[model samples]
Target: MAGGGRGGTGWSSLPADLLLAIFALLSSDADRVRFRAVCAAWATAAAAWCPRPWLVGSRTDRSGRGGGTVSSFWLFRPAGAGAALLRPFAATVPEGLDYLSSSRGYLALADPSVSPKAVVLVNPVTGRRVRLPPIGFFKRWLDVTTVVLSADPGGAAEWAAVAVGFPTTSLAYYSSAAGAWARLDFAAPGYAGVEHYSGRFYVAFGSRICALEADGDAPAVIPLERVDDDGADGSDDEPKLPGGSGRRVVETHLVECDGQLLLVSVHDDVVYSSDDDMGGLAVDEGGSKGGGDARAVEVHRVEWLWDGLVRLVRETDLGRNALFLGRNRAFALSAAEFPACRVNCVYLVDRQGHPDGVVRVLDLENPWACREETICPDDATGGSASSAGWARRGWFFPNY
Candidate 1:
């Protein structure tokens, strides 16, 4: 009866408002495309809707000689039910380009195999690529950790692509206005993460956070201060280790959500497992066969005061947004836009030794409500060996 009208009984007879409401409920781009094909009215309604974020999967082809060829990147629409299929773009992502980070619907990639390797910013949707000036050092020696973009390179009037890693003077940046790459004097011996928020760059080193201006001067490091617990009883204490000591903060991620800078601290406890008769073998909890370390994650939001100091606002909640952290990129998206996504949650990827390509979803509201999903399913690539081989994995948000 929705489509019943004086003109006819076809879907075209449906009211424009009703068509738009139906299109807005569709979570998949492919489904929306099909809906748009239904009629011109439906197409107009679908075109006006905004797109949701995507989880990107990338695997390397190690079968080839002298390193391996980088496989095509896959996009998955994560829904409350599960991950749904979205069209794969960059099927032949340029050879040697290893995905490092993603920001504002663009991917920052680099080739670690070659010296003076090329670093590039690419938008898979638009197939637009911008190459940064080559670094004169080897990837191994430099130990470049993460690269972040000030804005989407494809459309920003003036943008900056910054790379941070080990060794002194390890901060390198490319500015569109300058049209070249320049090294910053800021030295972070143990750099952890970098983020661009509210027209300024914030870098995380160990437990400290610093704000970097555009002039390339030395930024002041601000140490994190503890705040009173927001528990129902107004207790300032948190769960401690067996020995009564507080959990060790291993890593920190800086992110901007809703116009505020936040810091997510990763905590862990080293639990050693010893096996009998296997020569007193020791292993980390939840670790793979050879080795692994188990960690308990605690994410916190930082509140910047008007007096120029910052404090740990809270650790138990993320409000209406969810965070994605990995490969030096940390982003927050509103849960309202993606009904399937959980609010106050963190979606993380493991980019280290394990190549399982598992994506873990951690709920901030309830730490125990963690879920793991694999990005590369066994049957995804038609039995290819590279099907489960991921050179890098990240979160890619499409611009509609």
Candidate 2:
């Protein structure tokens, strides 16, 4: 009561440093947001405290609740040898809105019920919404892989939202500062992913990271120096799994961890549901690897040379942070800050292979080697159940 309650004479009068000290101990992001809402002084002191991310797309079984308007979001924490804690993070999102991309604590969801399809940014926890202007050139909103926000919606300043897809190299963005949705085209397309790092937005191609300068008007792309079959342990080189699993595809993501940006490459091995000559990728009721799982994963440190280019330095281990990658925009969390998170590890949802929504928990220290863990919604039976669409919408840092 001495530091954070009411008027000038009451708890709000305490030193700003003391309020921040208490904020550090609260742990959860929602608790910190509540603390900030105490008063203007408390909110000012908490401006610098960044909370760990909570995965975005978790839903309770429709067996109860009659398929209401809001769908709950959850965070999966490692509980024991083979268990998880599916804690409710954002519990009030609209029912039918499919999660397309997430940024600034809001999910860019596609409304499929409509004829042409609409994209709306929804703050899952608060039920706030921002309707973006439709790009006439681009009608396919669901195909967008990731959405990046310049700042949180409804804030004092103007903000922007950028949507990117690996398969579709076209950049479709909406800037509040500019007042309309614009699509930026590229002459040569080789981008595998895109992410915001430091102060600039970057696109990934092979082992290259390029900054997209002057986005809305007169944009220019600059790629970093590429490494070829180099490094002490072939880290920069795109990794390949031991020859057994048929038809493998590796996806790369740029993640900011412990003050530096990291390039993470994941190899998803394809599996078929039956022994019959299947025409396409299908999974029935199986394919969960336990006992030192050998899913190939690689992490590389991005060393910015500053003069319009950067280089990739191979990282053998992540000290205390775990990188979350899958369907959602990639984010990193420290185990020291969030105890439930496993240090030197990765929680990856298989978007390419698994149909039953089985998440692979890989140990970063030894990418091929991993411990057994079972992650699923608390309401569901296990990972064997059909939840492909829900599982693909991964985690996000819900700011509020």
Candidate 3:
């Protein structure tokens, strides 16, 4: 008969390796840290497994300071024991322009006051920033700047940063490769959304949606007809209207989902896909022979892409009004509402609920509780009658 060690209740005699393995399964980083000090052997294992640095989610509202020049701001994250305040260290920034775009860990700054205004690229986390050469749009009918971060897998090892400006008269693009800004001699109506998708950059201003190829060169705008095709084929295609004519068109918004670029256009009640191709537009044999009109464009009639995004939306307990979209699985906050939690930095949870998904709030700090008015400026608060802003502004239940 083998002799067992003391505390035979089963924990004392367990090998250090076995004990460490059991502790490794714990998800809480705080819990993991405490377990390490239980023993020297345990500490060694804990250090290796707990190497992920905790990135604080605290962000300032660039639009909320000084006056109404900037609007209300909200900061949010997943709910859990880790839900703590996210504070920022002081930093310097240029005057006038707002921070319009962020990607590849950098923020795009545009100065609206200056003629041919200067657009500066900044990385707040690393404290590194750069100002690009000016664009000649001072006297023009308002030029808007948008920036996106992209990685060209088929080309450069480093990520590519693109800045696009649309003036009433023309359009232009800037790239880190040129190390300078240049003009794009084209016309677009007006873009409602711009973002980076799947290692490639995307733009949705006006009626047309465009993408840059992963090869890292100047990307061509996709004509309305071919907007659905993948970008793998290389053809020198110029943008054109539905009748292959030069008429301007535009969309209200665009979003990236499951590797595909989706656009919701204002012209027609349709939702078109770029098939995740860095390509511009696509067409079918039977439709869009005109090239610009959404000839057979896949349609989803919701005005906002978020409305048709059924996957992220879910029903909650509060008369099915509360809903939450989790990073892993969806959950509900109240009714058609999802409460923010403190698990990680997850502010952009759609109405969809998920396991890891959480809604983060800036002022209402606890991730494990709720307040009478979960939403700011809500109908309950004498603001707009619509509660949409309440959800969009990032409020959630405290899961921790």
Candidate 4:
């Protein structure tokens, strides 16, 4: 009735509060951007509300291989099947860039075509990019296992970026305030994973958890104590490393949920074959071709004890949050926020060389009830059941 006078009511006639509420329900960043473009009032309201996160997918070639010229990307709504292909800013993201990791809406990319590989951070939403020193700066390390950011580069005045490699003997970190990459002196030969939480960097080396400051000072190492070990039950069938080897190959992940740090341990078994290339060696105990298929995953909540030591508090169940762990980045989403997502579950992309690009959902409460779904369907990625498709893929979170 407010704008009922001549040519019916228009979107601009809507009240500011009502427009803010309606825009808040929009889960897509593109939709929110269009909403703000409607009029001046709508734009003002939309600028105040925080938008929900979106799951982004990189466009692969028809063959589903990892690195090629990527002209466009895809966005998937967390709550529904709505997806859209988006073109990134030209200067920010160049052609033939391979995505490695994502944090706070920024992507860490590598250009394989260049000598000594070029690494840069890209924010697609803001069209901002910052190129770091070449990968060779990190002591000529060919591959970086994980990269994490201390703050969003788009909004923060100062930020820190950490790049770690497998069999890590030291860490290479970049601080915006210093405008240079500095090496953190530490020896972690069996480094499993690294994560940034609570203004500190945490690393998992073998079975030990160590904490370091963002600038790489004040180190504290903690050993994890398992409460439910089979040895404690006096069982002779205690689990041991594969092939009766005393040393075990484990995959570790550090995640932050509800303002708490969580350590996830995934047991892996390494298999050696004379005919196979060392680059394609399998890391999982399941004898799979890749390390993507984890045999067992255990989650533990980190607790700071009174004796100035850190201990792991095992969590039997996750209440409403579901975790998604990829090759480098990890995400925690609550079912209450997105009803379509399952609670107490872990979702991961197919690592077993499956052509279908299947995503596996593991239910922590009922481990035997695991399920698999195809994300890059045949029609989406242009891959058949037999073709080796989309070798390199990752999850992206867009914040605008």
Candidate 5:
């Protein structure tokens, strides 16, 4: 037997369930992979630990594990649950390649090492990987607006779906099971961004919010206007916004908060944008019919409260500013407004006062903080914020 090896008692000696329980407690993806390498028994333990897509009522806890992990994960440890980046699995991709987007626990990476224009989809937790289909001609031209990983709303196992938006106003999808890429049936190549939440996936383009219905053969596309019709499309020649003023030109971001789809944008300090047009406005002649990117869009004044609980606790005109939400509320911060020409502190405006109490201010400057707001922009525009409860441990892995 090898020195220091447990010759007498192997991993099999452990009660199968007990081994599973222990593995479940170690949330770090790197740790999980390391445990598998110890011996065949450990590997078996990991294989037997296939997680069901949904763990009902099982909250994501991420409090301990010291600083961070090698990759990012929404994981649970005995201490707590939160989002963190686990160490990257040993894989080949070029260096300086950064993470682009993530959804359904999968990430899209842009590494210059492999191909100059390709994005790699990988599950940091299991080190499962899939190379995105070649963007072909589009790769040679338009910049990729967004590349997000999502699960089929219909409940497919171990199969992740990829949604990519192009500046050419096109949207493409790639599925793990299909092993191929195809364009979504929707028209208006103006598709800009995507997000997944509450058993559904959403894409925001021009002024439309479309939902993905994976329950059928092919994912069904439903316009979100049925629920909330008031969305802004910036392509209109003479855009109309609330308050009789022209709509503030700004970008949109999608976030899953408290089981509801949330829209956030930063237009101006203290005066985030708001969409009072309950009727749901539309851009007139914005489509190709319009000469320019005439997409007529509405902006909403947003005040992020605590987590996803509160909406519009404050108000402002949103435009080039960056917005972020946590728990029930949201915050709007703009680099252009700050004298330092950068965000230094991101104060959480709870009902009573700032969560940090003004003394030990939340360091918005922390790379982690910036990423909190920026990495997963509701619109995938890229910015940063503080580490959420679940994002602490895996902060080491860059989520882009």
Candidate 6:
């Protein structure tokens, strides 16, 4: 909010109450985060607001991981209305660690050299970090898909973290009270993604929804008789996913929105199978097949149908809410509340976990129809990557 008072400089330094009032009017998370970045006074004032976390995308310049390999990560707002009104959150990250997904405001980083997998949760905002116990002698080939937290480590001493990915039979979790990473092996078919909601972690598998209840070893898929438009519980009326141009379902995420549960499924023609598989990323030097890295995103509202039964109804209008969906703990933000986000849309981190991949925001048209929104960073042109290292990691909600 620039204004020409006192030689065009007073607007940046508004009183706390006035800034809080202005913060209330923003509908995008990015704008609110930028609001705090205005100056020292604003950041202090924002502690009173504790605004929602804005979406952050990273560009890891995978073109060459040559020498000393220190990567800098910048967390900015994810809004379709793309003028960075504030300073983006930035940090000079240490070398040898790759960014996994983010939770609360901490970046879940993986140290590959460690036997098995050890994730270090670092909050770039306050520089507070929690080193998770490395579980199992798991190899790097068995990649961990996404991670979610029950509470922020800075805000609470006890936190629970859940991660799911490759090999398909196991998920990893951390209980700060237990003080170690433990694996919860399961017998379910390929789990797509998991979301921590209502004190229970919900896991989505093939055509099924399951919830992890209270330190349980694994989640059991909830059987359901689909609820159709007629309000009848029947599987016959389950809506077809919004089909795209030969796009395949690469990732599925469960998130909480508008006080309800939402299932977000991402489809793409070009999937990044190997981030370490950088050789293939080079093949598509044409830039995500002319910026078509992610082709379609399908969102469904979860309808709990009493007694272990659930229905997934397709949601067409998200109203003021926009969602960030990927391997990370899925989350939704309101444009009416934050103003920096696009209303009724899905923000996608690149599939195949490419730090330097593309970020696509798909506008929700209807259950059966959706077109991509132009989601480019502020420094880029036409919502497309201007150069290399433009891949988006995921969304991180910042409190500090």
**Highest-scoring model, TM-score:** 2
Local accuracy of candidate 1 as per-residue lDDT tens digits, 309-374 = 555554556678878776567778776766555576666655442344555555555433334233
Candidate 5's TM-score = 0.44
Q: With candidate 5 superimposed using the best TM-score fit, by how many Å does residue 372's alpha carbon deviate from the native?
A: 14
Q: Find the 10 residues in a row with the least total lDDT in model 2.
A: 277-286
Q: lDDT of each structure?
A: 0.58, 0.60, 0.35, 0.58, 0.38, 0.59
- Which number leads on lDDT? 2
Model 6 TM-score, all chains together: 0.69
**Candidate 2 lDDT over residue span 297-376, tens digit each:** 56778876655445667676788987787754687888787776787777776542233444566665642233534454
Model 2 TM-score, all chains together: 0.73
Candidate 3 lDDT (Cα, 0 to 1): 0.35
Clashing residue pairs in candidate 2 are: 55-395, 56-395
Q: Across residues 1-400, which tens digit of lDDT does each residue of candidate 5 receive?
A: 1243366765456766787788878755577777777767667776766441101000111332211112222212223433211112232222354444444444455543345466666665555666766655355322354555555222466454545543434455666666655556555543244666555566654344566666544666665432222443233322234555544434444554333454533211112145353222223221121122222323332233343222221122233332332211122334453221123332211111111111011232232222221112111112311222221111112111
* Model 5: lDDT to the true structure: 0.38
Model 4, span 1-400: residue lDDT tens: 2365466866677787898889878755567767877778888887766433333334444544556433334423444453212223322355677666778778787775677765688876666788887645565444465678889877788888777765676777777887666666556555456778878777765446666555344323333333333335212112333234323435567889888888765545333333221221212233232324444455778886555456566665778987766656676777686554567766555542244454445556654332323244333333333554444445566666
lDDT (C-alpha) at residue 29 in model 2: 51
Report the Cα lDDT for residue 107, model 4: 78
Candidate achieving higher TM-score, 1 or 3: 1
Candidate 2 at 152: error in angstroms?
2.3
Give the CA lDDT, 0 to 100, for residue 380 in model 5: 15
Deviating ranges (above 4 Å) for candidate 6: 1-15, 18-45, 48-89, 187-191, 216-248, 269-289, 351-356, 366-371, 376-392
Model 5 misplaced stretches (Cα beyond 4 Å): 1-29, 32-96, 113-116, 137-142, 152-160, 166-168, 185-191, 213-222, 227-249, 268-400
Q: Comparing 5 and 6 by lDDT, which wins? A: 6
**Among all windows of ten consecutive residues in candidate 3, which has the lowest summed lDDT?**
308-317
Model 4 residue runs over 4 Å out of place are 1-31, 34-66, 69-94, 139-142, 167-169, 185-191, 214-249, 269-294, 352-357, 370-379, 383-388
